[model samples]
Target: MPSIDLTINTDLARRILTGFIRSEIGRIGLKRAVVGLSGGVDSALSCFLAAEALGPENVLAVRMPYRTSSRESLEHAQMVIDATGVRSLTADITEMVEPYFARFPEMDKRRRGNMMARARMMVLYDQSAAFGGLVVGTSNKTEILLGYSTLYGDSAYAINPIGDLYKTQVWQLSEAVGVPEVIIKKAPTADLWAGQTDEQELGFSYREADRLLYLLVDRRYTPQECVAEGFNEAFVQAVVRRMRRNHFKRLMPPIAKLSNRTIGYDFLYLRDWGT
Candidate 1:
């Protein structure tokens, strides 16, 4: 049985991702990139790469925090800005999200959390137009595979350099790209509320998830194969079920087929589609 080790060449990965950012931003005829910083390793890695790719002055790292967001998250976001010399701003979504939240007094944590994520996205896109930057996403392969992100919110991005990377691989690249050690070592969170950690919500650590996900997704291991390779059967079933349930979140809203060349179904982006 092949063991799951998602180790990647940090230096090579950095060069490729930075190049990808530069190329994608240039393709959009923009020299600037905007990143919503959450003081997490994923976003920190994106900030570093974008700054290197588009020059620090051209990269905008926005901290869109809710009132319940942790102080450490805000500070760590600033640390990333300071380290990369990226242009930065702070947008407090507490005020922006208050109206709906005030109106719906009985909203649960999941509903409220999704609202906050979309609220931050609203701030990022407004800043994108103001700063002449494209919104770069921070989600990695593990979360993307696990459906751990809010769609059209944290998942909304003009382009993503790290979507192909696993969470464990993200930390490795972060170190090589000079991301802060403190940011790299901290527990991951959406900062939707105080005392919220991603692992606690997911009921599994990224380290464990990465290994299993690499086996299941990247290597295309069947659940039975994954179990045979040492994963607990219950855990394998649970992960598979989660992935299947959230598969729709990973795709664009489906268009009912009518014309042979429907917009999303057939009118796809092609090489040299525009100047």
Candidate 2:
């Protein structure tokens, strides 16, 4: 496969993302941010950036773990909290989700995982309200493009500073911003289940997926073009098809066009109310 340079100027990206967090939060008339720290690089980086942008006192990192969650997950999350000195709270999600899980005994791991994810999101939003802050998002572009996230769950956010960065870039930026080396090196997982790792679940490594996604989506290469560039034809086709199938996850729910001023169709100006 043709090599793609995913290397980024970490200093520059860090500056831009920190500024983005500050500006986005400021524009909403809020000075604080609440982040769900999953002990993964993505959330760790988001928490770090948020703390830098809004001061440690202004950023709250919430770790929501289920019964089967790893001890390392909590330890890793605490590492970020300690390293950044951000206020944090740990909310165990096992109880919150177990009732539903018990109600549907037949629900498989995927369904259970989704419930855990949404349960964590609920905790973050509740903390957002209690802490008087906006919810900062941690999902990266690669995951978003592949629809790896659960809608209204890990995918929901008031503002996302790292959403445009690919998963490869997320690691680069994380290392640049002093995210724990262990976190940067750990297998990427949501910790929703005992042995659930992201790449394993997706059936492809982030490195492979990110490279192909960069070519196909960022570079607008067709599947045939990607194959010509040395990507496996089947792999290219699969990634492209998945991206097409998940396009809706990247967009707002379609509003049926009825009046001249539809909410999403015509009323699209974010600053129409004069921010």
Candidate 3:
């Protein structure tokens, strides 16, 4: 099997990401951050970075779990909280999403999963306001590029320190930051449903996907070139198609260009223009 080395300088990445979290939060005049900790390596790494950037006391790790979420998820999340000394809250999202789930008894797992994800975001934003902090994002480069995240759900964040890192890189940094061993070793999942693992849902392992994405995006290889680089043709085309199809999820909602100074177009500037 063709393999690629995606190893990163964990120490350098740690310093840069921690500095990014601090500066970005401070830029907005906030000294604290709230992260949705899912007991996955991604969120665990994000929480560790947030704690390092802002003191543990200033970082709030919220564990929003559905009723069917694994007990191990809660346990692993707590492990991060215990390890980081960050303030923690466990908000069950089962009730928040059950009303809608009950309304549509026939709703498939995909619709239900999206609802659960959005519900978790709602909890995070609410906690962000209550905790006086911004939402630190946990979605990594691999997931973002493949459109593996839900719009306005896991994808929403004030600032994302790890969005640029691939899943493999997340593991590297997670280990450097002392994320629990179990989290680093476990199969990746969003825990939206009982048995739904990320690889199973996507039909590919993150290792393979990361290599293909690195070649296609970072190395600027075309689909044909990627296939030539030893990736299967079908895998390359599927990933390319998904990336193109979900391009809208990576962007802000388009505003109709009705005026000379539209919000997203002509009048593009920081919200704190004079501050």
TM-score of each: 0.97, 0.97, 0.96
lDDT of each: 0.91, 0.90, 0.93
Return the lDDT, model 3, position 189. Answer: 95
Worst 10 residues of 1 by lDDT: 266-275
In candidate 1, the residue pairs with backbone N, CA or C atoms under 3 Å apart (3 or more residues apart, or in different chains) clash, namely none
Model 2: per-residue Cα lDDT at residue 227: 88
Which scores better on lDDT, 1 or 3?
A: 3
Candidate 1: segments with Cα more than 4 A from true spot? none
Tell how far residue 267 is off in model 2, in angstroms.
Answer: 1.5
Please give, for residues 144-262, the per-residue lDDT of candidate 2 as tens digits: 99998988899999999999999999999988889999999989997777888988888889999999989887777778888888888778777878888988888999988888899
- Estimate, for each residue in 1-275, the C-alpha lDDT of model 3 and write its tens digit: 34567999999999999999998889878999999999999999999999999999999999998889999999999999999999999999988899999999999998998899899999999999999999999999999999999999999999999999999999989999999899999999999889879999899899999999988888788889888877899998989999999999998899888877898888868855654
Model 1 over residues 9-77: C-alpha lDDT tens digits?
Answer: 888898899999999889868899999999999999999999999999999999988888999999999
In terms of lDDT, the poorest run of 10 residues in model 2 is: 266-275
What's every prediction's RMSD, in angstroms? Answer: 1.2, 1.3, 1.5
Model 3: how far is 17 from its true place, Å?
0.7
Candidate order (TM-score): 1, 2, 3
